[model samples]
Target: MRIYKVGGAVRDRLLGKPVTDIDWVVVGATTEEMLAKGFRPVGADFPVFLHPNSGEEYALARTERKSGRGYGGFTFHASPEVTLEEDLIRRDLTINAMAEDDQQNLTDPYHGQRDLEARLLRHVSPAFAEDPLRVLRVARFAARYAALGFTVAPETLELMRQLSESGELEALTPERSWKEISRALMENQPQVFIEVLRACGALKVLMPEVDALFGVPQPPAHHPEIDTGVHTLSVLQQAALHKQPLTVRWACLLHDLGKGLTPEQEWPQHIAHEFKGLKLIKAVNERFKAPRDCQELAMLVGEYHTHGHRALELKPSTLLELLQSFDVYRRPQRFEEFIAACEMDARGREGLEQRSYPQADYLRGAATAARTIAVQPLLEKGFKGPELGEAIKRERLKALKAYKENA
Candidate 1:
């Protein structure tokens, strides 16, 4: 059995990046042979083993054939005849196709080394068209490499366009699509994915609702770009620049999707946009097979347009009431995530300097006071069970009304 380092480990090493996961390609190694050598077989669909000592993945050299369409419809071949070069050739991008031997000798038959030197994400072969998932993969890679200033090769971009136009991307499973988009969202510059998706027409299939936001008009005073789509993209870029969390970044991308469908009559008059946006955000999350908590966080961000210190004016009772109403304990950290998401959305909007809002310090103080008051043991004061619940409800409502009247 011959072991060679493969994939991201080699790529990252070449780029002077920290390598975390090490993948190995084993040449001429059968499953029985691997098991005899104390390697544990792990993969079911194909031959893959875990190294006995290092515990790193060691997948047998394999070749693939397109059985139908999209990502999962594939047949794999792993035998003595399958060369390492053949396996690398089937990969989506050159940057990921290079491999290294135990002696640190690089094997790049596809000129991946040259592409790396040129700072380009080039496809390994024309066979990239066989897998529609490559389109999303390349887009995500572009997002990851954007800070490194790498551009996708023209031919690769053209292939992506062809796959998008042919509706091949539609054949991808929702789970696979979500995986790539989620990874892209995790990147520091997800606008690269947005830009690439727009260019290739893939955005239409993955998120038509978001695509509808494109060119949808917004008021001039608030959004100088004149379109909610452009404004949303700008906000997303801002969130990325701030290196926010995945949920916050996703919220920024989707915070204004509902504005496209809202009836626009005048300036600062998109009434119920937040409520409408909440519904649309939930729908999008469901469509993408997101977890229930993720959907809730998205809804929270969409519903609460104001964030950070502004949330402090909401009154402790009102904030607690909202939290308890949503069963926030079911997803312990969701409320904090929602708050972060809302803050990112608020900060992303353009022309924030001209808006009349409370000072950041005031907002922070209000929020802190609200949290303290809400968390206090009001029920412990000679109250029990149903009575305690009723008392808390009445007190919460009273607090909300008082806050509203004072404001």
Candidate 2:
């Protein structure tokens, strides 16, 4: 059994980036051979084993055939006849299709190394069409590597467009779509991801709510671009530029999702879009099976768009009351996430009169300060038992009053 490093570990190593996980390809090895060597068989559909000692995965060199639809419709072949070269040829992208032997010998029959050098993302073969997931993968790679100046190969993008047009994207599960989206949200430039998906026609299939933003008009007074899509993208750009966390970045992306549906009869008609967006986001969260924390964060973004800044100036009692509006203790990070998202949202518009809301800066600063102060048990104040609870309540009221008076 010959073992070689494959996938992200090798790609990261070649790029001089820190390697996180290592995958191995086992050449000339059978499941029986692996089991004989004390490797535990774990994969249900593919011949994957874990080393008994190291616990690292060692997948037998295999090839795949399209069996049904979407990403999951694949049949893998791992017989003795399947060569490592043939296995690599079936991979999604040229850069990821290369592997290295245990002795550091390169096995790049697909010219992945040259493509890597050229900072290009190219498909290994026409067989790429067999997997619809490759389009999302390419969009993700665009988000991750575009900052390094990599460009997707033209033919590969054409193939992605064709896949979208063929409706293969419809077969993708929302869970799978969100997985790629979450990764993109975690990237340095999530806007690139949205743009890439839009270019490939995958965005409309995956998230039609966002697609509706494309041509929806915004007020000229607030948004110079006059399109909800551009405004949403601008917010995403700010989130990326600030390097916000995943949930905050997602909040920025979805913050204006309801604006497209808001009436355009009056300028800035999206004033109440945040309220509408909350229900829509909840439905989306449920459909995508988002975690409770993410769902709560999205809802908070929708509910408090106008009041988040005002919340900072509330008295301690009022602040505590506001905090109780949601499970702040269980999800302490959501407030800051909301602030970051709202900041991005407020800053996204292109043409606001010079001084529409000077309170924004004050509100942001106050929110940050409030968070820092709230971490301490000011209510306890050297009291114990029932007195402790009373002191805590009194201090909360005092803090809220202080905040409001100061603002």
Task: Highest lDDT: give the candidate number.
Answer: 2
lDDT of 1 by residue, 1-407 (tens): 67789889999999999999988898877878889999998998899988899888899999998898778888999986688998888888888998999899999888887888899999988889989988888998899988888988998899999898987887888798888888888887788888888888888878887887887776676566677776777777777776777777777788777776766454335666777777678778988887665565677767765534355556656555555644544544665565555555555566662344343334333333333345247655767878877876666556545555654
Tell me which residue pairs clash in candidate 2: 315-400, 315-401, 316-396, 316-399, 316-400, 317-396, 317-397, 379-392
Runs in model 1 deviating more than 4 A are 263-269, 306-333, 350-364, 371-387, 393-407
Point to the candidate with the largest TM-score.
1
Please give the TM-score that candidate 1 achieves against the real structure.
Answer: 0.86
lDDT of each: 0.75, 0.78
